[model samples]
Target: MRIAVAQMCSGISPIDNARVLQNYIGDAAAQKAEILFTPEMTGLVDRDRARAMAHIYPESEDPVLAAACAAAKHAQIWVALGSLAIQPIESGSEKSVNRSFLINPVGDIVARYDKIHLFDVDLDSGESWRESSAYQGGTQAVTARFGETVLGLSVCYDLRFPALYAGLTNAGAEILAIPAAFTVPTGKAHWEILLRARAIEAGVFVVAAAQCGAHEDGRKTYGHSLIVDPWGQVLLDMDTEIGVAVCDINLQEVAKTRRRIPAIANRRTFALPKDFG
Candidate 1:
């Protein structure tokens, strides 16, 4: 099947972001893509944690979510609406969840996966992020079927946790989707490496759509959106632009790679060695 990964530069306005996404979706559809994917923070990117929290709403009330569903139905292609900030159900709290929606071609939400890993770190560049301060962490890993392929869902920080990918692979996922808005420092250093490693380890196809360039919040992102095959080969990559990378993926490759390596089946559970002291 032909798949397209969209790299975007999102700002603070959901309307504007949705328009950009609409155009890209149209382009991908014109190219006969069966499935399309977008990056994290697909609706909006606000550096002000408080403002972002205030803007959150239930999925039904979110304009971007509604628009994306309509677009998916119009395009007749399955779409992964990377991640959006969603208001929590709890009352009297300012917490939200970073959630991804899997929309079928009929514009129905088939499955949802909230970002499991929150990025809470103090960077060496004097930039500290406490993602948990504003966003509630998700507890489940999810996968959905698109044609004959089972696609696993994951978001930005979740890429750092190998166990998540392993779980997805074990759950019969043939393709893994990682949509991210990674900081420049981390993206440059570990983005490709981690993605390739995950693909190689799981012996599954990996599609990563990402955000790039600077946002209105004065934060920069590394935009190297990539699509890697089961053998850890990059099929297409977009470097710092609002564009789409198109590639043809054959599901048979997944089985072939796994048969050649068989690492997933060879996994062993063992206790750590005793300490010397």
Candidate 2:
């Protein structure tokens, strides 16, 4: 199946982001892509916690999600609306859920996965992110079927956790989707290597659409979107550009790579080593 990953610089307006996403969806459909994947925070990208929270809405009222679903149905293509900043349904809630949705061709939302790992760190470059302060983390690992492949859903910071990927692969995921809005520092240092490692370890394809360039909030992000095969070969690398990267993937490669390496089948459990006094 042909898949397209879209990279964009999102601002504070969900409406504007939705319009940009619609164009990408159209482009993907024109290329006969069965699925279109987008980066995290596709609805809006803002560093100011208060301002972003004030602007966000629950899934039911989000114009971005509504627009994306309409575009998906119109294009007759499936969509992975990477991740959205969603307000809580309950009144008086202090934080929101960073959520990802899988929309079918007819616009029905088939699956949803909230971000499990919140990025809460104080960087050495005087930059810091307290994502948990504004968002609630997810508890479950989710996998869904997309045409000829089974997809594991994760977002941004979740990519750093390999055990999550292992669980997804064990749950029958042949492809892993890691949509991100990565900071420039970490993206440059660890993005490609971590993605390749996950692909090699799980024997699954890794498709990571990303957010890039400078945002209106005065924050910069790394924008190299990538698609890696099960053999740890990078099929597409969209280096720091706002565009669509498309690749035709064969599901049989997942089987072929696994059969050769047998990494998943070569598991052995052991106890932790005793510490020397």
Candidate 3:
């Protein structure tokens, strides 16, 4: 399947971001891509908590989601809308949900996965974030089928959790998607290693589209969108650019890699330690 990974520097306006994404969607369709993958917070990426909250809307009313689905149906291509910052169902709530969606060719939402892990950390670069302060975490892990491939869905912070990827791999996921808007320090130090490790350990293809460059808010994001195969080989990597990177992938490599290593089947169950001195 041919997939397009889009790296964008989104700002406060959902309308403007949707317009930018429509251009990418049109480009992907022109390139004959079967699917397009966008980065996290594709709808909006403002650091100002109040302004972000002010513009927050539910999935039913989000203009970005509507535009994406409309474009997908028109292009006759599938789209992985990396994520959107959407308001909770309850009115007057302070926190919103960081949600990702899978839109089929018919412009229908086939699957939705809220980000389960919130990024709350202090970095050596003097960068700190408390994502949980503004967003609620999800309780479920989601996997869906697209055409002949089984897709595992995850967001930025979820990439650090190995157990989550293991669960998805065991649940019949052949392709794993991690859409992120990662900080510069962490992205430089741990991004590629973590992604390649996940693919190597799980024996599944890994596709990660990321936010690049600086946003209207003073915040900056590291952009190195990557696509790795089941054999732990990097198929394509965009080095900090705001553009579309397209590549063709074959699912047969997944089965071949799993059969050669067979680590998933060879896993040994062990009892947890109960007593400690």
Clashing pairs in 3: none
Q: Give me the runs in candidate 1 sitting further than 4 Å from their true place.
A: 90-93, 272-277
Residues 176-242, candidate 3, lDDT per residue (tens digit)? 9999998898799999999999999968899999998989997899999999999889999998889
Clashes per candidate, residues 3 or more apart or on different chains: 0, 0, 0
Question: Which has the better lDDT: candidate 1, or candidate 2?
Answer: 2
TM-score of each: 0.95, 0.96, 0.96
Task: Candidate 2: list runs displaced more than 4 Å.
Answer: 90-92, 273-277
Model 2 lDDT vs. the true structure? 0.92
Q: Give the better candidate number (1 or 3) by lDDT.
A: 3
Regions more than 4 Å wrong, model 3: 90-93, 123-127
The Cα local distance difference test for each model comes to 0.90, 0.92, 0.92
Q: Which tens-of-lDDT digit does each residue in 1-277 have in candidate 2?
A: 8999999999998889989999999999999999999999999999888788777898899999999999999999999989999876764676899999999999989999999999888978797778888888989999998776799999989999998998999889998999999889889999999999999997899999999999999989999999999999999999987978799999899999999999888866779999999
Q: Kindly give the stretch of ten consecutive residues in candidate 3 with the minimal lDDT sum.
A: 86-95
Error of 3 at 30 (Å): 0.9
